[model samples]
Target: MRTEAIEAWTQLYAAVGLLAVICASCAALKTIVELRGGTVAFPHATWTQKFLWFPRLWLRFQLAYMSGFPCIMGIALLYAHYIGFAAFNPS
Candidate 1:
């Protein structure tokens, strides 16, 4: 019973952490796009760069090179360690 309780709580914590990381990633991507002055072209990018690939590449670079990956990995590692702990002590 206690083991089941721990397993349930671990799953719940992981789920909450996963949601938070996703939200943070979206915010990070949006901020990166905004900082790079990427805009939604309704009619035209009269004064700005009019290449769709620029923003796409920029966001991809941000996700790959910036802190997003590490943050997600760290959260994953944390949950993994928690599960490991639970696994080795199933009392």
Candidate 2:
């Protein structure tokens, strides 16, 4: 019961971390396109335009690059470790 719950939670965390990594990749590609003077269309506007109009978007990008993906990956790793330990020492 508890082991099952832990396994489920670990899977959930891994899925979320994967999503974060994908998002980070997209953001990195957008940054590269913008740097090369190429355009990337977002929902409403181009990524370049968004960065210019919303300075916070730039900060968010930097934050994601610096910590967001790593933090999510860390959480996923922690959950996986817990699951492994629980499996080995069933108590």
Candidate 3:
């Protein structure tokens, strides 16, 4: 039982960590691109920008992604805790 829970918790945290890394790196990349005079993907985005806009939303998509990022990740953490992963338990 303990081993299984540990494995599950490990997997859950791994996924969450990967998601965080990807999000941050993508945001940084988009910022760098913009700093280099490239167009930001928002408001008047191109067709391609529409599909790859999530990370760029850090500074481009405005309030939605900015607020949604923490909200979404928090929900994921709550879900992990609700699943009986003791490692994820907040209290």
Candidate 4:
């Protein structure tokens, strides 16, 4: 039972991390485009419409290049590690 629980948690973490990384990666791409003098459309006026990506995902919003990729990667990694800790360790 314990092993099964850990296995399930590992899978869940992998899925969540993969999704977050993918989204952040997409945002990173947009960040690059913006950096290169290309404009990425916001496409929304209302705050909710703009942040419709996933709850309050900061990656859904534009961040400065200096803090964008690094911050995104850091957050993704942080969650992955935390989940890993919680998911493993036989109890």
The candidate scoring highest on lDDT is 2
Please provide, for model 1 over 1-91, each residue's C-alpha lDDT reduced to its tens digit, 9 standing for 90 to 100: 4767677567857766775668566866676675567553233355454555477656654654455656666776676576665553546
Residue by residue across 12-58, what tens digits does model 2's lDDT show?
66677676777689777767666467453334377776667556547
lDDT of 2 at 14: 67
In model 1, which range of ten residues has the least summed lDDT? 40-49
Q: Which scores greater on TM-score, model 2 or model 3?
A: 3
Rank ordering of all candidates by TM-score, starting from the highest: 3, 2, 4, 1
What is the descending lDDT order?
Answer: 2, 3, 1, 4
- lDDT per residue for candidate 4 within 1-91, as digits (tens), equals 4985678577666765676667667776766676466464444578777776343334534443334556556765676575666555567
Q: Of 1 and 4, which scores higher on lDDT?
A: 1
* Candidate 4 runs further than 4 Å off: 40-91
Task: Please give, for residues 1-91, the per-residue lDDT of candidate 3 as tens digits.
Answer: 4666677677777767777666666666656677567564264367787765665554463433354488558866776776665654433
